[model samples]
Structures are given as structure tokens and as C-alpha cells.
Target: MTTRHPNAGLERLHRETGWTLRQLAQEINRLGTERGTPVAYQKPSVHQWLNGQLPKESVRPLIIEAFSRKLLRPVTYGEAGFPEPAEESKNPPATVEGLMELGRQDMDPSRRSVLGAGLFSVALTVPGWQDVVGRMEAIKQNPKLRIGQAEVRAVLAMTERLSDLDDDFGGRYARPMAAAFLVNTVSPYLKAESSSETRNSMLSAAAFLCYLTGWMAVDEGAHGRAQQYYVRALELAGASGDHNTYCHVLRGMSVQAANLGHGAPAVRLANAAAEAAPESTPRMRAFMAGQQAHAYALAGERTNARTALREAERAVNQAESQLGTFGGFSSATLAYSTAEVRYALGDTLGSIQSLQDHFRLRDSTDMQRSKLIFSSLLAERQLQVGHLEEACATWNSVLDEYPAIHSGRIDEQMAKIASLLSSYQRNPIARQTSERSRELCLK
Candidate 1:
């Protein structure tokens, strides 16, 4: 008979959690449901896992995530007595090859669900600028294929068009197209022969596209997949020695963390972005500082958050009008960031006021998707403050535009509309809005 010893690492973590076997099993099962791969794990499964019984491959991540959430820290596989995943154990692939694989997976409809199932890890190891700078794998360039400034320009133009699509419509439809482009066109261009300047420009363009794709993924709530794309963006940006794009990608990651309410990681990433910025213009300073303020607020650093917000305001004041600034940090954007910071700090009424200011500053150039999202947020806050009639009016406007936009974040907001207004159904406007929300959800 084989002697099966207990898993000491798992045992230690379990003890630290102070959870009974049943509680641990329940938490894992809950997380599984959240990931859309529901499992009926019970106490027996937990006991077996603790007693040297290896779990099925898919269940391992759920276990780790459950521990991470409960402990409020990253719990690695090693700490949970699991072997490192095969992909992690292997030598990392070349940037181009890796990007192709990721993009291809994203492009395939059947594979997208699996990709979305990837769990967001608080402990994801992000590469430093020094580590990745100029570190792209040597391409075995085909002498027959040469790209120049024109090709780089084409990539940039295509990315701009995609951004427009993402803005008007939403990421759910736009992301697949972006992924296909990355795999089909961008990957080959990366591997093609070009002058050093042309090559670096192409690299920077590709990095921006990757960042946009990741931003779309975040819109669709595929956070883990988004993080993967963001990392690739960072690697490409660093390889091109594009300090601006590198910092921009870091700020995007901070936004992702903040949206998911992972405050510590958000603060860390936002601060990293600000710290790594190179010769930043005033607009860029506002962009970085605005995100820093949001992140610091989320992390409960009131003093730091206030200081960052003031710096962002100062930078915005100093910035001159420029076309095509990265992420467009304008007065409107600042107002939105202020709202976010206020909300994070429990200033609900102040947040609503800031959001109103955001709309007042908005112009025709603002994204339709963003308009709906901010409107929905404004309505939610209005409802929280007992302005039921005002909230209903705002939601009606959101519903009017909702059918045209396909975004996971927007869908989430729509889902909340019914629940939030359920208690106020006695009010006629709330009743109508709730019914309309349900109809949209059904569609």
C-alpha cells in the first residue's frame, strides 16, 4: 500500500485561512460559479486535496484564487502545494510568437470563453522597463519582405479606426476584429525587415494596438485576458524603447486594478507608471496624476489622493491644446477622475457633482460608449442619494443608447438598474425604468 502524506503547504494555508473544510470547499465552489465553470465541491473534495490528492487541472486556480481573496494577498501554486503550471515552467516564447498565439486565441469565438475563464491574479508578475527594454527576440527576417514608414502609418491609421469603432460601439464586437488584425497583419509586420527607425515605429504602433485591445478586454470584463494583452503591450513598448507607451500601458493596468477594486495593486501600478514616465508633457502629467489620484483613493490614502488630484489639475492648467494626445486627458477627463476619487473616498454626493461637471464639459467628440457609462454611473449615484425621479430620467437616456453599445461594463450597469429600482417600484418613473431595463436585459 502506498503511504499518502498530507500536503504540508496546503495545510499551512488552510490553517492560516481559519476556514473549516466545508467553508474552503464552498469558497472554491463560489469562485468556480463566478468564473462560469460551476463546480459542486464539498468537504470530501477539500479533505482529499489536503491529504495528497491532486485536484483536476482546472480546479487548481480556483483554489488559489479563493485563498488569495480570503487572505487579501496573492497565494501562489507553490504555496498551495501544486506543481507549477506547464506554461509557466517552459521558457517564455518570443514576443511575436507569444502575441500571435494570444491574438489567435482571442480571435476564435470558441476559444474566447476559455480565455475569459482565466482568473485575474493579484500576484501577476509584471516585467520592469529595464528587464524588457530592447529585449525582443531576433527576427529571422525574410529579405523578400520589407516594411517602411508607409506600412507603419497604415498600422497607426488602422488602430485609430479601431479605436473609433470601440468608442462608438463597444468592445465586445470590436475586440475580435482587433485580435484578428493583430494576428493576421501586425504579427507579420513585426517579423518583417525594415530600417531601425521604421522598425521601432512599427513596434510602438503595435504596442499601442495591444494596449487598446487590452482596454477593450477590460470593457468586456475579461480582466485576466486584458492583463495578458497589457503585459505584451509593455514588452513591445519596452522593446521599442517607447517610454511613453510603456507608462501608458502601466496606467491602463492600474485602471484595471482600480475598476476591480484591487486597491493595493492599483496604487502600486499607478505609482510605477508615474515614476517611469520619461520627459512627460503637461498633458501626460495630468493623465498619470489623474490615474494616480484614483488609485491612491482606492487604496485609502486620502492625503496622497488629494495631492495627486491637485497635481493633475495643475498640469491640466499648464497643458496647451494639442491634437491626438495619448488617452486625451482633458478637463472632462479630469472631472471624471475626480468623480472616481470622490466615490472611492465615500464622498457619494461629491462624486455625483463631479460626474455632472464631467457631462457639462463633454463635447461632440466624446465617445458614445463613455457617455452611456457615465450616465449610468450618474443615475446609480442619484438613486443612492434618494433622487429617484432624476435617476429614472438619466437611466431612460442610457437605455435609449444602450441597444447600440455592446459592452460588458455597460451590461453590468444595466443589470443593476432593475435591482436598484426594485424597492422604488411604487414610483411610476422607477417602475417604467425598471421594466425597460428588464426588457433590455432579456434582449
Candidate 2:
């Protein structure tokens, strides 16, 4: 996804650091071995990375990981000449699952083997990906408009599209297209201007990307990497001077932290999000408060958690009232976020009821698959309370759709369903459901 010449800074940095690609790779190998996460690097592959040439997209993260470990401080993508968001909102709708798809594809060592995998967003509404590439080429032709804020915004919008929509109606086609526009076209924009506003907006964009990447790490059970990303994202959000975006990133961090059982920081982070973004649009406010409730629930502060949930509900109601006549997410996404908290807090009934309310507000098919995960999680809570027959039935009902939706979030939910059914795998109905889930869902 890097757009600058593959060796954007390779030639400069490799010499300055006095480390050959092979030397760095060896250091990486040694570091990983010492840490007990040994990685084998091909010498030729190391040479290719040094000279850029894209260095195989699969090796991008390895390079990042190796450098981050060596630096002993955070090494943001922007600093590495990797494409960073220069303009756009940080929280793309499919941000959670999209990054995992990125990492999954990156697992392959072969360049072509790493197919287009991480794509979602409404940004695909743009013209063809080739059109975008052409546009980037044209930017090179124009001296005045090349780095203009308008062009930067255009690129940011395209990135958003790649992370939102999941219509099997060719979503894979959109991934590389958007990545191309960002890397080849937009990344140069980051270097165009270091003006205060541009810098702030770029930071906001970078933070959002971090949030997406962190969310992906969470799906893979990589807790420490996920936490580090969240912390850096939070800092970037602060640097951007945007309370709304910062809160959103923090809200995401709360979910990750809570899922990893870091109850206290989770609670604190979500609470700060809610507090700082108090004047945010009603939907945004609900998202923050919902995050607060989730963190409190994980912390076992039932009384406080319940109160925050009520506040979240109040925020949702206020949001709906304001957008009473309209059907658009800019107003309704907060309630969907709130529903997720309901499930997180063990409110299965509430989650189901809220989701039912949300079923009609969508303009994208991506939410259809998302709704299934919410339903599955609700069933999980049902099983927790001894509603085995209903839970088995509920999990089975959605099994029909599981195989087709490859989002990693669905993977986690399916794994949970599988675990829940394990207790009753011997039962006839349970056996059928477990096999269906395993056979259909575990890719």
C-alpha cells in the first residue's frame, strides 16, 4: 500500500542507520528468536526490501515490527514513509474487520499470493481504481494542485470507501484500488504541507488508521500489539486537537481493553471519551457513553455500569429525535454502537431489541453481516444464562450465513458459538449445530 517509490526513504535511511537490509533482517531474526517468536527471513527478500520495489506487501508488517522493536519507542507509519491518512474521519465503519483482512493477506510470502484482502468503506463510490491511479499520476503533472488540501481530501474520502461496504458485489476489487490511491497518490500529500491544519488533519487520519489496525490485531488474539496501537492512536488523536475523533479512538480502545480484561484502563479510557466529547453530535455522544458502560461492566461496577447504560440510551434517544425524519448513519451509527455495548454488558434482550430497531436504517449491505454477529453474541449471553435450547437454536439459525461472511469479527463470534456448544456437543441438536458452525464458519 506504500505509494512513494518503494524505496521512498530506503536509500536514505538504510545508509544513515548503517544497517543493510540483511543486517536489519538478521537483527530482526535475532530479536524474534530471543523473544521466542522466531522468524526466518530470506536473504534475497531482505535485499529486495532494502531497494524497496514494494518489498512484498507481506513483509510490510515485519519491517514495521522489526523497526518498532529496535527503536524502543513507537515508529508510526508516517515516519516510515508508509502511507498515512492525510485527510478524512478516523473511524471508518468497517475499521474493525478490515485491518485483520490486511494482516491475513500479509501472511503470504509471495507477492501475488497476497491477494487483495482488506477492503471496506463507502469510498468505493469513486470511479474505477485505475481512474484513481491515473488521477494520482496527473497530480504529479500539476505543480500547484498536487499537494492541495482538496486533492488530499479526495484521497481521504476514497480510503473511507474501502473500509465500509462489503457487498460480495466485488468488494475485493475495491481494496487495492483504494490502497493504490492512498499510497501512490495521497501519501505525497502528507509531505506537501506541514501547516498546522494539515498536520492536525493528518494526525487525525493516522490515528484512525491505527485504530483500524489495532482492531484487526484484536481479532487475531494479539492483545499486546493491539494495546500499543491503541495507545499511539490515542496520542495521535490528542495531537490532532479533535475531541470527537479522540473520543472515538478511545471508545475503540475501551472495547479492545475490556475484551482483554484490562478493566480499569478500559473504564478510564471510555469515561474520558464520554467526558471530552460531551457536546459531540448525539450519536457520537452515545458511542462514547456506550463505551463507558462497556468498560464499567467489565470492571464489575454494576451500579455505575447500569447508570452509564441509561445515559447511553438517553443519548441514543436524543439522537433519534434529532434525525426523526431522516435515514442516514451520520445520525444513527451511535445507536448501533450502543447496541454493541448492550451485548457486551450481558443485555441480550436489549441488544436484540435495539438491533431490530437498527435493521431498517442501513444504506449499506455491510451492516447485514454485522447484524448477524450481534445476533450471535446475544445468543452467547443466552447460553450463559442456561437457555441452552434457545442458544443452540439461535446459533444454528445464523449458521446458514456464516460461511459467506469472511470478516474476522464473525470468526471470533463463531469461535465463541463453537465453545458455547462444546458443553452440549454430545446432545443431538447441539452436535448438529456445532458441526454446522465448525464446517461452515471456521476458515
On lDDT, the candidate that comes out on top is: 1
Clash count, one per candidate: 0, 12
Ten consecutive residues with minimal summed lDDT in candidate 1? Answer: 1-10
Model 2 bad stretches (over 4 Å): 1-146, 165-186, 194-203, 220-223, 227-232, 235-239, 278-281, 320-366, 416-419, 423-427, 441-443
Candidate 1 lDDT by residue in tens digits, 1-443: 11278899999999999999999999888878767689999999888888889898889999998898778788999988898999889998889999999999899766767778766777778899998899988889978889999999999999999999999999988999999999999999998899999999999999999999999998988888899999999999999999999999999999899988888888889999999998578898999999999999988999999999999999999988847676689999999999999999999999999999999999999999999999999999999999999999999999998999989899999999999998988888899999999999999
User: What clash pairs does model 1 have?
Assistant: none
Estimate the TM-score for candidate 2: 0.57
Question: Which has the greatest TM-score?
Answer: 1
The TM-score between candidate 1 and the true structure equals: 0.95
Off by over 4 Å in 1: 1-3, 18-23, 42-44, 322-324
Per residue, candidate 2 scores C-alpha lDDT tens digits across 375-437 of: 676577677767788778778767767666645556668876667677797788888888887
TM, every model: 0.95, 0.57
